[model samples]
Target: MTRTALRICPLCEATCGLTVTLDGDRITAARGDRDDVFSKGFVCPKGASFGELDADPDRLTRPLVRRDGVLTEATWDEAFAAVQAGLRPVVEAHGPDSPKFSASLEQGGTPIAVVLGNPNVHTVAGALYPPVLLAGLRSRSVFTASTVDQMPKHVSSGLLYGDPLAIPVPDLDRTDHLLIIGANPMDSNGSLCTAPDFPGRIRALRRRGGRLTVIDPRRTRTAKLADEHLAIRPGTDALLLFAMVHVLFEEGLVDLGERAAHVVQADEVERLAAGFTPETVAGPCDLPAASVRRLARELAAADSAAVYGRIGASTVEFGTLTSWLVDVLAVLTGNLDRPGGLMFPLSATGAAPRPAGPGRGFALGRWRSRVSRHPEAKSELPIAALAEEIDTPGEGRVRAVVAIAANPVLSVPDGDRLDAALASLDFMVSVDPYLNETSRHADVVLPPPPPSRGAHFDYAFNALAVRNQVRYTRPVLPLADGQPDECAIHARLILCLGGQDGADPALVDAMVIDTVLGKAVADPHSPVHGRQPDGLAAQLTGRDGAERRLDMMLRLGPYGEGFGADPEGLSLARLLDHPHGIDLGPLTPRIPALLRTPSGAVELCPAPIAAEAERLRGRLGAVPDGLLLVGRRHLRSNNSWLHNVPALMGGSNRCTVQVHPEDAARLGLTDGEPARLKGDGGEVEVPVEITDTVRPGVVSLPHGWGHDRPGTRLGVAAADPGVNVNQLNAGRLLDPLSGTAVLNGLPILLTPVR
Candidate 1:
């Protein structure tokens, strides 16, 4: 029997490198690629189950078409024809703007052509695929995960650094102090970045005389590792951040010289922060005033410090403001754009990568709908209004939709309403591997090949990588029988939509292979590059060589010769000589010579963010007295995709409402009892998990569950389906400026489900 070694793990954003032991054509066992420069042999349980996802009984091996309200197995050509027939008329009658496309940020598998071909599509794949597509689509009716979750960071980054994508990452390896707010890196690995072996990094931080502090409503895994954990109220991160800034300014502790010239609206920031003393905002934030003051001082006294925030900061009523304030605090403390402080990651490739875009800021008491008008932001009307947009009689109505790799019925706000809107669509198509809740409504489902068959690139995560390192993986196995290449399938769909294909598929495929090998060959940063060429080649082949090609492209790319560039340094054949992985050094901050703003200096506190503060105050007056809704995360699930992987799903049930003990008592609900969570658009009955981890009056429900589709063959997910929290989350209640749906801090009534 013949053998081939390969490394490719598509579990989460971590994208950990793996080495599969192949016996002839069968994959026998998988292990972490020991010499992988990025992950460094850190493989999670999900990575171990790659073969399971490949051979799972639930895997869709063939295309299925809906005929007369029934789905039947069909040939790829037949399925393509059906998709074209169904979607063409909708685009013709309603215009391309009628369709909306959404995808996950975990992987950039969607072909660029599909997104660029249509002016109407939208997605959540940030910094990587979206920019490439945005350059092509140029449509105003766009929505992404950024606005709904990370817009605050983008807005904040823009205010502090002139570039919205210049998000500051905490230098865990070098910093003496780290202040984390509203983010749980432990569970998320690293939101907006690929930080594999996070626990190990945290441990290293402590070993190097660094101290970590966490400010969150829950004592998350990341918090447990911290030297101190401050349990504050949700949606009050901005106030907390502002209080910290106030402390820095009042005590003459601020490094004004570093930011004085670049600082815009300094007077305004000082004035706003003056009103938010620790004592003044402590009551609303539910944290001790003295502790807040102490934290501010400690952060200031440290040799080097950085502040970081994520989904917890962005998904709230004041998400954008909170995100902005975190950056403000970083800038005021002389931490912005500094080593051992808040720093930006440089992209290896020549591509100009911006982590977030500056959308329109917040809008005031905008007209809300009776059914769900949530506010409009950045021209994307609230998702809650999706049903209305589809059903209401009017011009430019959403008559059709083409969702790529997203299950809005379970993932988006007002899932029930979105489901209804989907059902009402004149035409719909889903590019997914399963018949999920959203896909069940599609006229045709265009399934892409498994991750093992596609090339690997952390195009999105590279800009946010904890360490500035790059690696690529080729597929360990060949494309499964009769399955169209993922890119080809997407290209065909885009062509069907009446648009010209951009990149040649063959070129892309070859480039992907070349890029992976090139990176491996040229990587001076890799520990094994000079020693283990065969192992490197095995891994590069698994990544479809895109990783290698991307590295090569970056070296010769517009950026000009990254750390690994050398004419005689490396090649694909050289990588084939090694079998172990390679090593890249720790990531560091990089600010390119071209700042791009009118002024070369970083813009501290830009005008757009200052305007948003007033909008936030006018819209969400104060925390209401009802159960405040918030979204929570889990380590195993990667939005809607991971539910299909049995290994990740074998653990304890992850979907449940985390209610405060006091609140659970008031509602007469015990642990394990069902609670009916009601909002403006819909309601869902979820099992209660009474825990003091949550603050009183606030209830937490895990996002990305509630799979109720009869057609989906996810046996584990179907058997243990949880409530679709998005159903209760009406998109109509949105941050008008950013057009981000308020997924957190929405008022909802809860009662024990008898």
Candidate 2:
């Protein structure tokens, strides 16, 4: 029998709705859901091939345990036993004495744990269970993909609004002018700032007579569609942005509008912008002084304007400074907290509007990594330092790792070293569906069922959506017999870490519900202020622990029902009634309530940002002369996970260095000929794709490759394994403020392979 099921595409950040044609347990086809509230029938290449990815033969169907130093198929019970046996000794013998930071290590209990994947935000099990597992393990040496990808933005948002989660996204649908820096929304389909059909949105803006400008080192797809493409030098975004600010201040275009009353340190911002004029930075940023002035002037003159920067801007030497300047420009032009400007997204699952007041503001450097003492940003250590923490000998050095859906060997810098470090771990476990580069080193690998066999929701992406909306999908296919869902797999892992190896996973969910309800009932602001925790638990509805938890969260969320206080308000039941999704509407002005700073106002000139600006000023005259390397995004792939799927591996998805014709000629490199690209860490000989898309002195390679590692079970990915670009990043260069790897604009030397 053929049946159609609604599912949210978990391939990327776009989170578009998908309709799957299923035959029993098999997913036959996938297409855009026309009735979806947000995407509205728009689907990308990654979304369209959902069925093929879901049914990939490379996916592991059973747990694998290392017996006799060789990974072999094992039963779930045997896998759990192996995990408990492997991790318990490491935790008891080598755990850090305290969660707090200290210069000297005093080890006692709780082995080091690290979560290093982007998939955590893409799936339900990924979003819900990692925190519980981490809490159970209680390790201070935490690491996530954020540091390598988007930690700078989080740090900048924390410093600006006093809350790291209080990120403001550009109002793409209504904006009159959109200035994008170092972002290819057309390729990524929008990241951090979630918007479905990003290319269509750009076209819509153009059709509506809105000016669109893109500033990047390469002429990306997004740049090709823009009104102007500023091919600025890599690692110089902060300089270019500060120069724009200088132009705004110099021309008397600084207007805060309503923000004037809620903003602090406007004068300090002006002082910081004093010396970084367009002329001073033009030489470093590779942008003309006239063009800088015109961009600033056009932004100030626009009916509404927004300055948005993404990964390219965030993963640089001056990442935090560049990120802060993005918002600084938005505020200076009076485009913040207004329609057609940069605004906060109110997700359905987010908390209800709280009283606008001072909050316990966000903080950084609460602790530092063991090896390098890199300050923790947003409670995560720099992923670049993961190798040292494991390899370096110390009292509190990382002895064990619990990696979930992560492939750090390909994703992180210096993969060769990290690969050896992983082999040296006292214990290692990976919760992933494939035995790829990273998982191949694990003592026990717990493979989660495919997306088709698991329910789906956009917990993280919804909070970052350009528009406020909510949608969900139950599992399209039944779980294979004896194959646990991801949630169950994660729950079991948490139980093992907590020393309750065989405990019912549902107890974890129940305990969380009781704790949340107990707190809510005591709070005067809660709708069920005086309600008993037991009563609320009884009222919750779901088929499983994960669903029940989701129900409780939805009922208490901003758009939720508040447990009958607002009958028509959101709930799991309410959402289930609407399969396509319910559009909560567009983003609105949210400022005072959103600001969590100690002063309860926007901190335009945070001291950290100002300090970094001074450092940026010091680099105005020192421009390195070499071929700078940057990573490019493919429309078909999302990091390292999709390469195993054969459907996404052809055409433009191939791994080859993108070099300009002029640069290729200068290096004596011919098209389709191999070239040795050397960087600080190492070198790789990759075929050259000569094109004018990149600037003359720059080269580009796509991230998430290098599938050639031995003992890996990924048949498709290992067949014609592509080179790993992160191998060139030795994990030496990092943004001091956020500890983000300088993935873009790093100087490299290229030589043609004879």
Candidate 3:
């Protein structure tokens, strides 16, 4: 029988609500849920193609073990055994037969590397399991997709707010003016800043007579909608932002408003930005000095304004500086923590706000990569260094890798090198649904069941959401006979990696519950403080361990009931009762109460940020004359993930390099003609589309293509496999503060292929 069910789309950061039509156990169709509180009725192409993705046929339903030299189907027990065998060598101190897995590792064992992908935070398994698994292993070697994408934002936030996770999103519905730099939220559905129907929100801002300004090298979908679009030179966002800051201070327009009490170092910021006057940065940014001054005056004159910068700002040489300046602009304009400005969203599951005081602030460089000695940011070594860490002979080389929902081969820089590096690995294991680029090298591939058969929760997205809300969805269909749910798959992986193979998976959840509840009761800030852990453990409600963990977290969260301490407060049971979602309301001001910095105020002029600014001051007018390269995104594609979905790979999503008409004419390039683009790493020959949308000395290439790997099962992607844009990246260039790959504003050469 066919039925309908509601689900929260985990395809992207938008986190739209989906109403799925199921025919028996198969998903037949998926559309937007009109009743959804956060997303409303907005659904993008990725959400609409859910059925095709869930039934791709190429998705592996069974585990595969590399028996001898060939991969073959294997039982769950055999698959996990193979994983244990492969991981055992990496953790020499703890063998598969070790009795005390967690305790033995407390003293610190040999490093076991782990790489988590962006998709992990979308599911309960990814959100709840990895931390526990890492703890069980006690390995310090860590890498994640964040290092290649959004690490700069996290680093900047840590330096500004003391907590790396304390990122602020613009209050789109109320802002009077929004300055967007290096971001195309209309296509990305917003990253770091999460909002459903992002384009619609931008349109709504215009409808309300609010002004929008875009800073990019090319005219993007969001840029076209702006009141004015400034095609700034690539990698010069730091210069542009600091120039605006200089204007804000120069014209006596420094208004911190009520947040002045919670923000410090205004004079320090003004003094540091003094060298980056509009006239000085105009040459580097390739924009008119008058335009830069006008933009600053507009922001200062607006009733309320927000400056939002994204990947374009984060994946460049001065990424952290650009990110920090985005917020500094907001703070200087009296928009830091006010309504109709950039403010932090308080999710239902966030830790209850602690008393405002000095806190344990964020720190970096506690660890470094062995090969490059790249300092750690957010406890993650750069993924760009993964290849050398494996191929190079060293004492603490990454002998084995636990890749969870990650595909670094096609996603990160220098894919060719990493592809060859994987062949030399001692052993590898991947928790993935497809034998794709990175997973094909794994000794064991454990595929989680389809999304239809897995429960849904917004563990990470909720914290980054533009609106304060909560939603939960049960599994649309039950798991098949021998299939394990996502949670069960992760729990099993944890057990096998912990050297306690065949242990009851339930123990993983039980131990987590005991530890969390035990700690919550001890902390005076928790609502459940002074409560007996054993008594509250029996009171949690859920059908499985994952749900039970969610229940515990919800009960102890900011909006949660303290084990009946607050009767009407949030509980998993109450959230379940509301089918659509519980709207916790719009973002409110959270200033000194949320400040965790050592000084109990926002660090307006962090030392590292100031140093980066002074570094930019040295290159005020020295812009690269050669063509610079930057990446672009499409509404239907999300970095290499959606290319396999045939329905989402049409029209504007095709692979081609965009060049300005003037540059194309000079290089003898034409529309639909192949062009050779060379970079520091290597060269790629892609079809050129000459257009004036891009500025004269810049070219735009989309990321997440080049799906021509031989072992992958993505039939559609391989049919017209595009060139991997990342091939041009040698993995040498990185943002010093955050270690994020400098994927944008890199010097490149272009010529007609002839």
Candidate 4:
């Protein structure tokens, strides 16, 4: 029998609604849900091919355990037993007498319990359970994809607003002038800032007489849609933005408007930016002095404007400074919190709006890593430092690792070193669907059921979405016989960490519910105040612990029904009735109310940010010598994980080094010929792709490649395995403030292969 089911695409940040057709456990087709409230029938290539991804033959169906140095299939019970045996010692060893775990006791519990979170942490059980597990372990040794991708933005937001999670998204639907720097939303479908049809939004912006300006090394797909595109030098985003600030102050175009009362350090910003005039930074940025001033004028003169930057502005030596200046421009132009300007999203599941007042300010470097002493940012150690924490022998060395949907070997910088570091670990476990580069090193590999068999919710992406909307997707297909729910697997893993291997996984969920309900009932502001926790637990509705937890979150959320207090507000049952989704309307301005700083206002120039700006100012005259390297994005790809899907394998997504025609001619490089490229980390011979899109002094390589690692099971990916760009980084260079790997603006030596 054939049946159609509606679900949300879990592949990327867009979180578009998917209409999947299944015939007896096999996914046949996937298309856009026309009635979807947020996406509005928009489906990207990844969403359209969800069926093939869900039914990939290479996806493991059973748990695997390492026996005598070999991975072999094992029963679920055997896998749990093995995990309990492996991880229990690390969790129990808390005292300094335990030589195996000697991390600083002052920071937290033993540093033995470590976790590596992937981008997928935004979806599925990954969003729900991993935090619980980490909280239960109480370990300071944690790593996530954020450090490598978006940590700078988080740190910048934390410095400006007291909360690290309070990030602002561009009001794409209403903005009149959009200035995009170092991001290609057409390919990424918008990252950090989430929008379903980013390309469509750009087109609509053009139709509405809105001006779009893109500043990047290459003229990406997003840039092509812009009214103007500036092929700027890589890694000079901070310099360019600072120069823009200079022009704003010098030309008397600085307008804080309604933000005057809510903003601080305007004079400090002017003093800091005074030295970075357009003429001073034009040479390094490869842009004319006139162009820089004109851009500032356009931004300030526009009725509404938003300055947005992504991975390109981040993952650099001055990443944190660039991120901070992006918001500084928005504020200086009076676009921080207004219609057709940059604003914060009010998610349905987010905390209820609190009275704007002095709050506990955000802090950094609370704890330092053992070997390098790199300070922790937002409670996560830099992914760039994970190798040394595991390999270096000391009091705080990582003895065991728990990776959830992560592939640090391929994702992080210096894969060769991290690969060797994993081998030396006493034990490692990976909760992933594929046994690729990173998971291959695990002692036990637990594969979660495919997306079709699991429910969907965007706990993370929803908070970053351009619009305020809510959606849910029930399982499109039933769980296979004898297969366990992904949530159950996570719960069992938590139980194992807690030294109860064979216990019912449901107990883990129950304990969480009890703890949450107990806290809620005791909170004076809670709607259920004075109500018994046991009574509320009985009133919860769901088929399992995961859904029940969702129900609880929805009931307690800002737009929630408040347990019958507001009958028409959101609830799990209401979401179930509206399968496509419920449009909550467009983003509204949230300023003083969203500010959580100790000052109850936006801190324009924090000390740390000011110090970093000085560092950027010092580099205003220093010029980059060689052809700088930057990364590119392909619409067909979403990091290294998605290349294996046959439906998305071909077309313009092939891996190659993109070099500007002028640079190719100057270096005697030929198109379609391999070229030797060496950087601070290492070297690789990649085929040259000659194009005029990139600036003359810059070359581009798409990240998330190098599927050629041995002992992997990605059939399609390995066949055409591309070279790893991270290998060229050598893992030494990093952004000092954010500790993010410097993935872009790296100087490299290039020679054509004869």
lDDT of 4 at 345: 90
Tens-digit lDDT string for candidate 4 (28-134): 98889999999988999999999998889899999999999999999999998999999887667752345433445453325564555555555669888888887
lDDT for 314 (candidate 2): 90
TM-score against truth, every candidate: 0.83, 0.98, 0.97, 0.98
TM-score for predicted model 2 compared with the true structure: 0.98
lDDT of 2: 0.88
Clash pairs detected, candidate 3: none
lDDT (tens digit, per residue) of candidate 3 on 476-508: 888889898888888988888767788988899
Model 4 off-target regions past 4 Å? 95-103, 106-113
TM-score of 3: 0.97
Candidate 1 displacement at residue 558 in angstroms = 6.3
Regarding TM-score, does 1 or 4 come out ahead? 4
**What's each prediction's clash count?**
44, 0, 0, 4
**lDDT by candidate, in order shown:** 0.63, 0.88, 0.88, 0.88
Ranking by TM-score: 2, 4, 3, 1
Per-residue lDDT tens digits of candidate 1, residues 656-732? 89999998888899899888989976898888989887778888888888877676778768877877888786566
Instruction: Compose the digit string of candidate 2's lDDT tens values, residues 1-754.
Output: 9999899999999999998898877888899999999999999989999999999998899999999999999999999999989887665555434333232333311246676598989999988888877766666777899988988989999999988887889999999999999999988998889999989989999999999999998999999999999999998999998999999988999999987899989889999998899999889888899999999999999999988899999999999999999999989999998989999999887777778888777787777776677888887888898888888886777778999989999999999999999999988999988988899999999999989889998889988999999998999888889988899898888788766788998888888888889988998888889988899899999999999989998999888899999998999998999999999999988889888898899988887788888888799897778889999999999999888888888899989999999888788999998999999899998999999999988999999999898888888888868899999989988999898989999889999999
